[model samples]
Target chain A: MEVAVSIITGLMILGALYAIHAKDLLSSVIACGIVGYSLVICFLLLKAPDLAIVQIVVDTITLIIMVAVVLDSSREELFLKPDTQGYVTTLTGVFLLAIFLYFFVISVQSLDILGKGSLRMAEQYINGAAQKTGSANLVTGVVFDFRGYDTMGEAVVLVTAVLGVLTILRIKGKK
Target chain B: MKGMTLIVKKTTQLMAGIVFMYGIYVIVHGHLTPGGGFAGGVIIAGSLILVTLAFGSDFLKLVKEEAGTTLIESFATLMFILIAVSGFFFGTRIFFNNFLPKGVVGHLISAGVLPLYNIFVGTEVAASIFIIFLSLIIFKEESAQ
Candidate 1:
């Protein structure tokens, strides 16, 4: 499982890099889709089927929208020659990434080993969750019951996003 | 934009129904399964997108969906809020309190209020996403003209 996770992560990085560098907008969008779909695989491998389901469908819809937009417009992105500023920006980005990676490794080492995470906070949720929520699926119980307010907030956020999109897309003055 | 071919259209006709039903199943069985409203809602939107892509969407049709989507999304959110707030009128007068009887653990009606939340949230999410897609399409059409 670890090996598969690592391999899929590698594939995701590859897809992301290609998406950033690809000249054709359509192919770039497809490469971005590859990254999202691989993330779905990662979610499933990590035993989060709920997230995987959302990721796959959301990724597909996002890909369709991106491809539609790209196809409607010009497919070819303007190619710019690598200048000194561009090289400096790339170096700064790589440096920032290395710093993040260093901290990530440190954090991983300081954490509990895999499969033995401390359930100090989740103990109650894990023990009496089935009886308290009266739901077979604990995740949904926690999401809808124990954390119902948070769920409502999430729904409100989604609604606000849609409203923002519609408002922004509306015509200026007349109808 | 036009559809691909006859074969694609025929395949979509058979498959979109299955996808739509699967999304409903996910939302209905949310308390008993790994999927819930949000995932199911996105899946439902996906089915709609598949149909729109395969058969092609019309300008007038999108306008209707746009209006209905906003209304349905608002309605679902209102229902969800009402259900949550209605808890104040029920046992313990607590917000989002489980006032309904929790059936058998594994049964469809097991969860007190989770299923209702899932159903309402499912509709809200589906309509929101569908409207976003519709708006994008309509924008494209208007821009093209």
Candidate 2:
């Protein structure tokens, strides 16, 4: 399991690099989709099936939207020649990467290695979800019954995003 | 967009119905399955998008005006909100209190308000995704011309 996780994580990093540096705009979008999908695999490996499902669907939709945007715009070359400020920009990026890597390694090492990190609320939800909500799917029970308000907020956010897209893309007098 | 070849169009026509039905099944049986409204709605939206890509935007006329889709999306949002508010008026004053009787577990109509919420969310998500795709397509077409 550890081997699988490491391999997938490495691939995810590679995909992120490709997405950042790919010359073709469409291929860059495809690389982004690859990164999203690899993250979905990582989620599944972590035993979070619900997150995997959501990630896969959202990833696909995002790819579609991005591809559509690319299609509408000019298919220009993604990376132009570096200017005089390139060295400074590269130095800043490497500095941020090093900082993130330092924090990431520290955080991973800080986690409980014995795997007893389950919280009290999670334990309660696991024990009482089926009985309380009468739903065989514990995830749904928690999402819809225990945390319905959060789901409502998510729905509102989706609605707002759709509204924003419509408003921004609206063509005047185009019925 | 003129769409793909004849073979792709015919194939999409054949498979779109099955894909749509599968999406509905996933949404309705969310209580017993891994997939819920959001995932199933995306699948349904994908099916619609497949048809649109195969047949082109000109075929959008058969589905009614874009305003109609937005209206359906708004109605679904209202239904979701109403369902949550109904929980307050019923058994307890708390929001989303799951007021209805919890039926037999592992059955189709088991999870009292869960199935209802799933249906509402499914509708809302499907309509919203479709609208987003439709608008993007329209924008692309206009810019392309």
Candidate 3:
């Protein structure tokens, strides 16, 4: 498990770096998709199947939207001439990266091991979910019943996004 | 965009139905399975988008009109709202309260208002995605012309 996690983490970093450095916009999009899919795998390895499924679908839709946007726009080659400003930007980025890495290592070391952390809500959900929601799938019960209002909010957000897209794409004075 | 090669068109024709049916299966069995309305709706939209890619926008004309797609989306959203509001009249007067009887656990018709919510959400999502894809494709075509 540790080996798999380490490999996935390495791949994710490689994908992000490739996405950042790729010259072609389409290739950059594909690299971003690789990073997104690898994170879905990481979610699955962490025993969160629901999250994995949502991530995969959301990733696909995002990739589609990005590709459509890229296709619709003028395909101009992005030229980045290196200068003093570029060097300073690169140095700042590296410094930030180092700081984040330090904090990340500290946070990982401070994390509680599995089965050691407080799980009050998780325990209650596990023990009472079936009887309270009367649904066989605990995840479903929790999402659609226990947290139905949250789901409603999510649905409203989706509707708003669709509406925004429609408004943006609407032809002036045309229904 | 015109239709693709014969092989691609034929393959999509064969696979689209199965993909759509699988999406419905996922939505209906959401309470018993890992997939829910959102996932299943996306899957269904994906299958339709695959057909559109293979056969082009002309194929959409045969299945559903542009205005009809928006209408369906609006109606599904309204249906979702109606279902939620019905809970107030029938049940504990709270919004989104599960009023219908929760049948036997593990059955297809169980889970009170959950399956209904899932169905409405699935419909709304599928219609919305279809509209989005169609509009994007039309925009691309117009810009190209």
Best by lDDT: 1
Once fitted onto the true fold, the runs of candidate 1 whose alpha carbons sit more than 4 angstroms away are A172-174, B58-60
- Best by TM-score, which number? 1
lDDT over C-alpha atoms for residue B140 of model 3: 56
lDDT of 3 by residue, A84-152 (tens): 999999999999999999999999997787546667787777886776776787888988887777877
Candidate 2 vs candidate 3, DockQ winner:
2
Positional deviation of B53 in candidate 2, in angstroms?
0.9
Query: Docking category for candidate 2?
Result: medium
Per-residue lDDT of model 1, residues B15-78, tens digit only = 9999999999999999998999999999999898888778776423767777888899999999
Candidate 3, which segments miss by more than 4 Å at Cα? Answer: A61-76, A82-110, A114-118, B62-64
What is the C-alpha local distance difference test score of candidate 3?
0.81
What's the distance in Å from true for residue B118, model 2? Answer: 0.6
State the lDDT of candidate 3 residue by residue for B35-142, as single tens digits.
888888888888878888889766557225557877877787787788877888984888777888888888888889888888888888887887787877675566
RMSD of each: 2.0, 2.3, 2.8
User: Global lDDT of each model?
Assistant: 0.89, 0.85, 0.81
Order the candidates by lDDT, highest first — what do you get?
1, 2, 3
Listed models, DockQ each: 0.80, 0.73, 0.57
Which of candidates 1 and 2 reaches a greater lDDT?
1
